[model samples]
Target: MSWMTLSLTLIFVFIPLLLSKTLNLGLERDTIVAALRSTVQLIAVGFVLKFVFDSEHAVFIMLMVLLMIVAAVQNARHKGKAIKGITWKLFVTFVVIEVLTQTVLLGLHIVPATAQYIISLSGMVIGNSMVLAILFINRFTAEVETHRDESELILSLGGTPKQSINRQLMKSIQASMIPTIESQKTIGLVQLPGMMSGQIIAGADPVQAVQFQLLVVFLLLSTAAMTSVLLGFLSYRSLFTERMQLMKIDVE
Candidate 1:
């Protein structure tokens, strides 16, 4: 698309802004800010990705992946600050998700190990994992707070820390994973995913685009499951005292 075409896309943005202004819903500022930020960020990332894709050096590729992990962890850690060592917990979770998914994809030769494929897939995997982590942490902390008395009572009755928090932990994991699972159930029928639609728009064969999108769908399924389970297990222990008592979480 030309610059003029891209500029015209602002009409889509203006629609929301007009609605917000007409109804006095107070979303005008946020809509404008979001549009500006997305425009700037996508343009900047496009340049960086072009450079990285052209280089295709292992070092540059690793750096890009590392940058993604760091950003994901930083964005996700705030929701779980109540959990001890949340920073490292999120870091480890993101890193593990990246490594594991790349290992499977590269190891099985499912995708090329070039910067283009690696960075693209890593972006989706890490991004999905970050969202899942945030969801799990948010739900987990709320669960712990809501069941604090019950957990303490379990501890008082000689239950282990793991036993006391097991229900909350499981509930959080399941809750966080439901969105991903449900979305996949209605993926093609409900809506064409962005990646698939973009490829088809770019004139790729419909079948090929669908195949690639399916690969992404499967990758995200695993990403959702692992993220919630790994982060949940890592975080739940921090919610307990050394003496097996339930610790209070100061959720913000």
Candidate 2:
């Protein structure tokens, strides 16, 4: 694509701004901020990726992946601030998801051990897992708040914290994972995902692009399940006090 073509993409941005203005949605500022941030971040990432691709050192790759995980944790931790040690919980959850996904890819030789493949796949893995983690936290917190009485009743009836919150925990995990599952179910028919479309535009064989897209979708599904279940189990306990009573969460 030429500079003109890239510049013309701004029209897409105008649609959102126009709708926000007409509807008085108060999203103009947010839309502009998001567009600007996305532009700047993608440009910076392009440079960093270029340099990493040239270097191809294992240590550099590890450092980059770790940085991505830290960013994911920071982005997700706020959603679960009511829970103690949420940052660590997010960090561990992302690390496990990323490692497991990468291990499968590399161990099975599904993808070549190239910087581009590793970094791109890692972004998808960590990004989806981060979103799932945030969703799980938000849902779990809301469920706990909504069912506080039921939880307390369970506790009063000699139920353990796990038993008291198990329903909410399962509900939260399922809620967070459903979108990923549903999207995958309709992936090919509903839309061409960015990865596949980008590859096809770059002149890759359509069949090859489809194969890669399928792999990514599978990875995302696995990540969605792992992130939700692992974080749900690890985090539900934080909602209870040592005396097995429900802790009051103060929403800011």
Whole-model Cα lDDT of every candidate shown, in order: 0.92, 0.91
* Regions more than 4 Å wrong, model 1: none
Candidate 2 accuracy as TM-score: 0.93
| TM-scores for every candidate against the unseen true structure | 0.97, 0.93
lDDT of model 1, residue 86: 95
Candidate 2 per-residue C-alpha lDDT over 131-160 given as tens digits, one digit per residue, 9 for 90 to 100 = 898888888999989998888888889999
lDDT of 1 by residue, 140-248 (tens): 9999899888888888899998899899999999999999999999999998999999999999999999999999999999999999999988888898778877877
Stretches > 4 Å off in candidate 2: 15-28
